[model samples]
Target: MSVNLYRFGKTVVTIILKPLFRIQTIGTESFPKDGGVLICANHIDNLDPPVVGLTSPRVIHFMAKEELFHVPILKQILPTINVFPVKRGMSDKGALKKGLKLLKEGEVLGLFPEGTRSKTGELGKGLAGAGFFALRTNAAVVPCAIIGPYKPFQKLRVVYGKPIDFSQYREQKISPEEATEVIMDEIRKLISAHK
Candidate 1:
């Protein structure tokens, strides 16, 4: 019924980023006008989230690493940026729950299926966590691909792939890891095209 747009994210996105990047967003129309969506993307630059956010006309919420949440200014602004924290390694129950809650509330949550940044800025191995969330929450999965080295003033193409139904996996009641793989693989195919 509602799309959760963060208070700070709206302002920061418009003010800090809109003028700087030549962001080309593809397939945004594919996203459901109102529903939970997991936006799984590749991680290369620290700027990935904002770049993705600005490129998107819709507001996207992200589960950031605990490390980034500790920084003072970022700590305050991150949450406003619609960014929340997640502990890496092992299962972060808190983060997962929060992500689910956001989705159930009709928020678009962003995730790096790659889990970590690519040292060489290429597509890396994707963690199935995002897919797990999709299956568990019964949310649509939007696979996005961003092509361009992480550099400012550089024109880049952020390709938003079609929103795929994970209903098949849901019907099978597959394991979370298994479901995650299916979701990540879709994201991988999108990434492969750009790479």
Candidate 2:
């Protein structure tokens, strides 16, 4: 039921955004057709989630800040569209469990590793949480980038980087910080490439 509503919402959003923003996408073929996958991207504006989610073919189960869920109407609508809340600035064990469960079920999980949006719209250092989940679940990480202006009628681009597999790194007992640096590097490249 949620999946159906997600699709419907995506279609509706696409229709609205396409004409207004001139949104374009590339490298979608990099997405894994099956198995658990992580979509990690840079967060610039609040519009990033809906833009990326609507543009991608996969139904992205996005981890959003708990505050957004408190909005009067959005609290009821967001869950139906695959948006779930996570407490910020601390480890939320319940959110982690929910994320792992979703990945174990071979679903796609979308996250912004920067932990928060960049006020200047520039890339920021990524938190280790994304790498932690990637290592724990052995999920493929797809680095994503969103570029260009956020205003209406401006061209916006979404680029998906090739999946980075950390299984070898996990086996070698690499530090979470090191692994996160690698993931963030790929995301940085994607953002730079698209710009």
Instruction: Give all TM-scores, in the order shown.
Output: 0.86, 0.96
- For candidate 2, the lDDT comes to 0.87
Q: What's the lDDT of the predicted structure labeled candidate 1?
A: 0.77
Quote the lDDT for 76 in model 1. Answer: 79
Clashes in model 2: which pairs?
A: none
Superposed by TM-score, candidate 1 places the C-alpha of residue 95 at a distance from the truth, in angstroms, of 1.2
Candidate 1 wrongly placed segments (more than 4 Å):
1-21
Residue 92, candidate 2: alpha-carbon lDDT: 94
lDDT of each: 0.77, 0.87
Cα deviation of 167, candidate 1, in Å: 0.4
Task: Write down the TM-score for model 1.
Answer: 0.86
* Stretches > 4 Å off in candidate 2: none
Sequence-dependent TM-score of model 2: 0.96
Span of ten consecutive residues with least summed lDDT in model 1: 1-10
